[model samples]
Target: MYVQIDLDGPAGTLRVSGHGLPVVELVRAPGSPPDAHTPIGSRRRALLTLRVDGVPASIGPARGRLLRRSYRVDARVGGVRYRLMPCGYEHSALSRDGRRIGTLQSSGDGRVVDEWEGAPDPLDLVLGTALAAAFGTGAAPWWETVGDIVGELIP
Candidate 1:
């Protein structure tokens, strides 16, 4: 399954989709605990906590400068402690055993992209993008659409 998260709009407004179907919507209001409904979350935080379907996955601050910064968030999901490292503008999800699980890519225009090798859970992708946004690296142009990038990558 393919998941896409758009964070190009106002802070706390995120649109999430699985393949071509709507899955959830996520919002992070200023000074309030981030809330997600309709499977919606992460379309938007300060030291944001990565929440998927109302569950916190990773906790970290979106620090450093663009292209030169890095996020070392602590992920506690599914009884697993994972590590997320920034790779350029994209981020990778690794198991505690250091195995590659999947990746969350970003367009210069501000859309969060998801790519993985196995049939990884969609929640993992959402969590990855949510963490990226939480750490403030989710930057994409306003006009880029998730549909536009679908089928563009043939891996």
Candidate 2:
């Protein structure tokens, strides 16, 4: 199965859609603050809300580690707790109860890959892609270096 996440929507919004899946929309909660500190060249963290077919489905925070490039997000979708964390370079593992059920490539194309038999649930795909988009992928620009240096000096 193939899933795609589109980040070209209006500010603070993401769209996830693919064949055989209903389009899911994720919107950043208003007034959500960026993480105070993040690993150099990594994306800043934010909290987001996921909606399926215009109904609130789940909410979570996506955050990056300080001094490391890894990131993770925790959310309860359909009453089942799920976590999305970096499993390798440019990809993230989606797990529940410590078992990885899927992987999402946050880099080029933003594809979600199922690790188990049969296609992944639509909610899992939406939650993983939403978290990935909010947390971002790959290296950030040079400005992040300045921010990191400044953050250290201030604290």
Candidate 3:
């Protein structure tokens, strides 16, 4: 089963729905900086919180390794450590214990594809989408920045 996330919803909100899953709403907390304005090829670090159906879900701080492009966010939902990270360009992978359980497409209307054996739990769907919406796709390949710099130097 795959959860479809609509990022084009009303400002500060995302809508998640899929097979056998109730329509879940994720709302960005007020005062959080929007991730859309981040420049390409730069690391994204947005301190944001999303409310699941009006209840605040505690999402841990996003972490990144020095000199690495991968960005990660860790959340303990019901005591299970869940991690969300970029597995590819514009794609966010959801994993537990180093195993990818799902993926969220960050472009356009996002979609969370489930790799779990059965229908995805509602909480996981919400968490994955929340993390993706918060930090996904603000950066591009490092070479893009270098290319831009070279273009400027030549001109």
Where does candidate 3 stray beyond 4 Å?
Answer: 1-10, 17-25, 31-35, 38-47, 52-55, 60-70, 108-122, 137-139
Q: Highest TM-score among the candidates is held by which one? A: 2
In candidate 1, which residue ranges exceed 4 Å CA deviation?
Answer: 15-47, 65-69, 88-97, 108-110, 133-155
* Worst lDDT 10-window in candidate 3: 37-46
Candidate 3, residue 69: Cα displacement in angstroms equals 4.0
lDDT for position 142 in model 2 = 39
Clashing pairs in 3: none
Tell me how many clashing residue pairs each candidate has.
15, 0, 0
On lDDT, the stronger of 1 and 3 is 3
Arranged by TM-score with the best first, the candidates are 2, 3, 1
lDDT string, candidate 3, 86-140, tens digits: 6566666678656678876554345434344355567777667656654453344
Which runs in model 2 stand beyond 4 Å of their true positions?
A: 1-4, 29-47, 67-70, 108-118, 137-155
- Tell me the deviation in Å of residue 92 in model 1: 4.3
TM-score of every candidate: 0.51, 0.61, 0.59
Q: lDDT score of model 2?
A: 0.57
Candidate 2 at 123: error in angstroms? 2.8
